[model samples]
Target: MPHPILETTDLTVRFGGHVAVDHITCNFNAGELTAIVGPNGAGKTTYFNLISGQIPVSEGRVKLNGTDITRMSVAQRTHRGIGRAFQLTNLFPNLSVLENIRLVVQSKAGRGFNILSMADSHAELTGPAYEILERIRMTDQADQVVSELSHGDQRKLEVALLIALDPLVYMFDEPTAGMSVDEAPVVLDLIAELKTRKDRAILLVEHKMDVIRTLADRIIVLHNGALAADGDPAEVMASDVVQEAYMGRDLEEALANV
Candidate 1:
């Protein structure tokens, strides 16, 4: 088998006295979308934090394409081809949508922001930014301030920013959390479009079963911060632990704690 693009070997993290993610060892390959699912506080997001360098690892190591990166900072990890979009909207509320994406493209191109001379000298930057916006179908809103966009549009823009980076691994935490039913599909479609790339590995943490069923090529379940099941989506979703720990009374109790 091909080496996994992203690998977590006995990956673990703790919050002071609490062990949030308990020794998870897994590998994610290119050309696959793996959905991470668990009840609240099951360490799904915490595990993401470990892989993306958002938090320190209490133990174990995170590797990208076989190179250990447990000590890398968040920016370093992004530079190494890991892009994550969070559950909340993370944007420059004051900047126009085009500017937001252009900044990323420019940064990726190694032309650090030129705040003093902002006279469109970088056609190379805007050209790709416009293409990203067009890919997400946000062409009409390119000039709008990010603060003025609806939650759904902002979510789409976040995905566009991730695309602008063109990371080898794409991580999303509930990409459609706040959108109206009608608006969620647009983001899902964008994700589905990314899934077609043979060089990309996608990791998603979502509670929505419909979204999981729709996009996940594989499913890995986390329970009490450990791997409960990992396999085909249909089989994993139907497994005993997922049925009991995630959907049964245990899940209700877990949700209450969260």
Candidate 2:
């Protein structure tokens, strides 16, 4: 088996006297998709922050490919191959879809800040940028302003930007947070395709059980700032602790339909 691309040892996060995340340990292996699900305030996103360097760990360590990165800055982690798509849309609304992605490609190449001067002249960036657009099925909307695209397309664009970074581990915080039913599948399919790569590790914090059921190879359940269950999706879903803490009776109902 391949080594874990990301791992945490007794990871914890504290806010004042409150513990948002307790001493939790988990490993995310390459070529796998792991879903982290829990009730609200279960420290799901907090755990992602601790690993992504959005927030510091109160105790414990985050390791990427066996290297301790507990103190790495967000930018440093990004360069070290940790990429994230936030629960909220984070994109330049004013820029065109192509421009938004090109900037990331350029940044990844270590170019200086020259958005205006480089926008028209950077053919090197355009090739890879357009390739990403094509992969995301947004090539037709390349020149369209990001604000003008539908919310679902914008979300897909966000993932595309992450693909441009080509990180070893991808952390998605509710990639389908606020989308209509039709829009939800578009983003879901994009995520599904990522799972086929078999060369990257994907960790997602999702509330939607159907999405989790369909995409997750493994599931990690969190409750009240601690690890509740971690195992195969079927086994984890059947767990009484998970059913009582979060799924309640709906899990059985949902599984029956599946």
Put down candidate 2 lDDT per residue, 165-213, tens digits, no spaces. Answer: 8888989988876677876786788778888998899998877777888
Which TM-score value belongs to model 1? 0.92
Candidate 2, residue 251: how far the Cα is off, in Å: 3.8
Best by TM-score: 1
Runs in model 1 deviating more than 4 A are 113-119, 247-258
Residues 1-258 of candidate 1 have per-residue lDDT tens digits of 666999999988878888899999999999899998888788998998899998899899999988899999998999899999887889899999999999889878877856686637778899999998888888999999999998889988887888899899999998888788887887898889889987899999987777877899999989899999999988876668877766664432443344
Of candidate 1, the 10-residue stretch with the lowest lDDT total is 249-258
Cα misplacement distance, residue 80 of candidate 2 (Å):
1.0
Error (Å) of candidate 2 at residue 48 is 0.9
